[model samples]
Target: MIYKFCPAVLLLILSFSPGNLFFSETKNVKEIAKVIKTSSETNEEAIYNSLNSNQFALPQLESFKEALKGFYILKEKGLISKNILTLIDFSMSSNSKRLWVIDLTTNTILYNSLVAHGRNTGNEFATSFSNSPQSFKSSLGFYATGEIYSGKHGNSLKLDGLEKGINSNARERAVVIHGAEYVSNSFIQNNKRLGRSLGCPALPLELTDKIIQTIKDKSCLFIYFPSDSYKGASKLIS
Candidate 1:
């Protein structure tokens, strides 16, 4: 005599399989949808006020605004989350390399650093880090990640995103936060010029690691400059 299994019994056996049970339990589409929705609601005006209320000069304030505009554009493109913490201001001046950290939520200056910018190459308009193509051949912009190194260069941060324009290839550059003796208020006073980076946003050796940890891994960072051309070119403002 021949016997055949019922179709209902076969279906019951397949449903009890380990693989099917694991797959059904692990898939949670609702949680993923919530995260994406929350990130989309990030407010732009809030981020702008956070940086503007800091102790920035007129030109620096304008640059900060432009940077905020860029951040807003990124938010719209779903490139960043809404929990923007702070915007750092580097005046890029040899006389005063003042750094200000503005709190986005409360619109206040949380931290301030007397940092240094690139030294004068006998060029007044060459105060920016992007001035000398041989030494620092890149424009001022923002980045996501940075790396700390302790080699012959001492302690320094490897800033990413110099090769690609702002918001492009930022993750690949490996830009990092590290300490540098050259980036200090004393350097500006002694040399009448600030220190220059090979393209990195050099900070005081003391605050390098702290800054790096604070703004690493998808954190928003904006480097400012008083250039109308850059402001015009920024898509966030446009």
Candidate 2:
């Protein structure tokens, strides 16, 4: 008489077959991991595309990509608590609106305003960076937004540098984010460039409070510059 096994039994038998008809546990795990990584990449790509299509200006694609990578890494490490990313593209001229505060959850650009680099960073472009106090040069890398407080700049946001040696001295250097009168279009029009800060990423006076409020409290901030040394040294991005 002919007999048939249930599907479950058949599957069990196939799982032990010499040819390995069914995936081994290791292979299954790897496949699942692959799927998860692919899904994550797809999601990142979607967000990038959405943000790129916005009507307002955006940071350069490469700069945004690096910043996004660091942002997710920081989020994964529990270093960032908010779904906000503030990007200062020091690669662009100070006259340009290179500071972009983006709401990552909504894939929207909340603020795209002019920002000033360090006094020693460069004239029109930020060509120099530092992690030293009194260097008066901006530091490039990832930072975590800290508590808000009123300082000499009125309302300001603190920044805790994430990458050691790259920007870890942010706190000691008093490199906070604040509004400055010289970080405006009018200043640029008159001076041919935005005024430089001591070492802070100063924003337009009108936008300082709002931008700080939106990105403060454990959000990610990335000051991007296409430098080979920084790219290789930054553990968050490298």
- C-alpha lDDT (0 to 100) for residue 56 of candidate 2: 81
TM-score of each: 0.58, 0.83
lDDT of 2 by residue, 1-238 (tens): 2324445444544555544535476675465556555665566666778884367876787888888989977898899999999888988888888888898878888889898899998999888899999899999999999999899989899999999899999999999999899988888889988899998999888888888888889999999999999989988777
Candidate topping TM-score: 2
In order, what lDDT does every prediction score? 0.50, 0.85
Candidate 1 residue lDDT tens string, 149-222: 67554655544442244434433433344467776767667866666654444578777666655555444566
What is the lDDT for 50 in model 1? 43
Give the residue spans of candidate 1 off by over 4 A.
1-60, 82-92, 118-135, 146-176
Worst 10 residues of 2 by lDDT: 1-10
